[model samples]
Target: MLRNSKSGYGWIAITFHWTMALLIIGMLSLGLYMHQLPQTEPATFQLFQLHKSIGFVVLTLAVLRLFWRLINPSPRLPDGMPPLEKAAAHLGHAGLYALIFALPVTGWFMVSASPWGIPTILFNVLPVPHLHVPAALGSQEEAESFFKLLHEYGAYLLIALITVHVAAALKHHFISRDDTLNRMISAAPGKTDN
Candidate 1:
């Protein structure tokens, strides 16, 4: 059950999918909460550091997940699914992967461009190098603003995609009475017939 079959996902894929989903949700919530904290609050800096550490972890996992996906093809969609639905599923997955990658990179850039010049100490242990931004980009404030916008807006889009993804999975499971969601949720041994 460690390797994927045509009808269902393997343990590895299920683990990666659920783990990343939880981490992404946690990161989004943490980001929103941290933003609301007053700058002078003692917890604000700690929250930012934690957020950055988690973001780095997400980025690393995203890369590994992408590699795993390339090497191991996904389970086939339930039979009778429309071609358009299949295409949407593919594009939605691609967008999720793209956001997973882009969010961290943009966050790194935003921190690097920050006029405050705070060092990104991963987990308060290792220092992560910052992305180098050209000085010709007007000013540090301008660069930070640009990256901030990208990071914030990208998060909104990711949330929307996740919402749709969840709704579609639910629809497949309930309305369609398909095995789409169960395939990822369960790993019980069974024939490759859905």
Candidate 2:
């Protein structure tokens, strides 16, 4: 059995991790910039549509990652980790999972409520159906508007959480001199779900 630390991250896990990270960075930057634009602007609508489409892809990938984790289980942290560090690691991971799942959900709900409707962007060549929500509370506009706010704020929270996560990883890798960073990067060949 190859040692976990020296094994390195499975190709799939590394692929997913890097790809999702890059995508999130793009989505967050674009989403924030696009939000600053006037709602009445034609480009604003298209920007939002692109954001929603990307969000859906992120959501799908998150679900698959969760499923992969459940099936394959993550490698254990380096032995003899301090209690506090372990706890922090746990919290960081949990927060990541929460944000990953929450982001797309909020986005989806907002798109559903959006009167303009969401557009699919498959390789920038497809238009997927807008997942619409049922009218129940009052006017569709009012509901969608409310959900849009939730989605927007949720994005900010996600960005903050990601910032914290990356900082912690750096701390572990450099300041603490711990295996925390290595563990994620060295999960054995083919063990990664990404």
Candidate 3:
């Protein structure tokens, strides 16, 4: 099925989940590598542009994914799941979605307020315009720095949440021996593992 069913995720949701996961991993790795580079180099500038382009792609996909989730509810959790675990799952997912949205917005705001005057050329084709910043922000540099901190911290928090998510998934698969992970991976709608 193309859409989510009560038994498990559909093709679209699985595609979105795995694709975003891969892109996020790449972006995070590239970001850490770029951070250590000498910023003044022409190559460093190119790297920053690449990072910004990927960030926009992530933001776009996140918007689509959120919209899809709104229309298609996720399958119910394992029958034996405890209330605490369910709460953690809900909060963890919310945190993930928040970071997925926040990181890009903050990065865009940071670039928009940057005094460096660099333009974001998406994939070397599309031109992305900066947001119109308010005058009350005082200096462009100050605004950029503030949003930069938000973006940076947001990335760290995202990494932590992903770690927890993966660990929980693995626990469900191995220790719990439930179909919790399998439903997202591949499972018939509403089927039980016996």
Candidate 4:
């Protein structure tokens, strides 16, 4: 059964939270490891392709999640939290939402600008067309360098934001022994009036 929180998050919100958490962790790992590979290796290109594909999937899921959040609502903070902590939590979540949107857009542009052409998926069977013409973007070297820097720096920012988020979650769950983590993880819904 769905438990109710003071702010009113239910099953849908919890489901989105946990699912995104897993996907984001996988993406962060992939992004970091791929960047470490030598640029000269064929495997580096393969990893980059995989990274783009995974990023597109994350973008789709994130859009759905954001739409769902807009239609529904998030749970309220625990009543006893300090104003500072509450403000921090709110800012942290906002930062997460912003990054979730930005990362995929940048990734898509990066791929689109590559001279080698970008691959696409339509359902499980059809391939879509690449959106950008490589000639229009620039020389191969320029396109590659520009998008690589965008992707790499964007990734670093995302990593920092996620690190702070994870730390905050841990602090809430373990140190504070609050329902912040439990609001998403517990099998039961919090105290719902209805």
lDDT of each: 0.91, 0.72, 0.89, 0.74
Q: Point to the candidate with the largest lDDT.
A: 1
Compose the digit string of candidate 3's lDDT tens values, residues 1-194.
88887768888998899899999989988988999999999999899999999999999999999999999968778878899989899999999999999989899999999999788999899999998877787799988888888988999999999999999999988999987788777645545633
Task: Return the TM-score for candidate 1, rounded to 2 decimals.
Answer: 0.95
- The residue-by-residue lDDT of candidate 4 on 81-193, one tens digit each, is 99998998899889889888788776776666666665755333556455563576578668767777877787788888889988988998899887677667664655532
**What shift in Å separates residue 97 of candidate 4 from its native position after superposition?**
0.9
Q: Give the TM-score of candidate 4.
A: 0.81
Model 1 residue-pair collision total: 0
Residue 13, model 3: Cα distance from true site in angstroms? 0.2
Model 4 clashes, total count: 6
RMSD of 1: 1.4
Instruction: Write down the lDDT that model 4 would get.
Output: 0.74
Q: How should the candidates be ordered by lDDT, best one leading?
A: 1, 3, 4, 2
Worst 10 residues of 4 by lDDT: 185-194
In the range 1-194, model 1's lDDT, one tens digit per residue, is: 88787777889989999999999999999998888889787789899999999999999999998988888867888769899999999899999999999999999999999999999999999999889987877699999999999999999999999999999999988999877888888877544465
Superior by TM-score: candidate 2 or candidate 4: 4
Off by over 4 Å in 3: 187-194
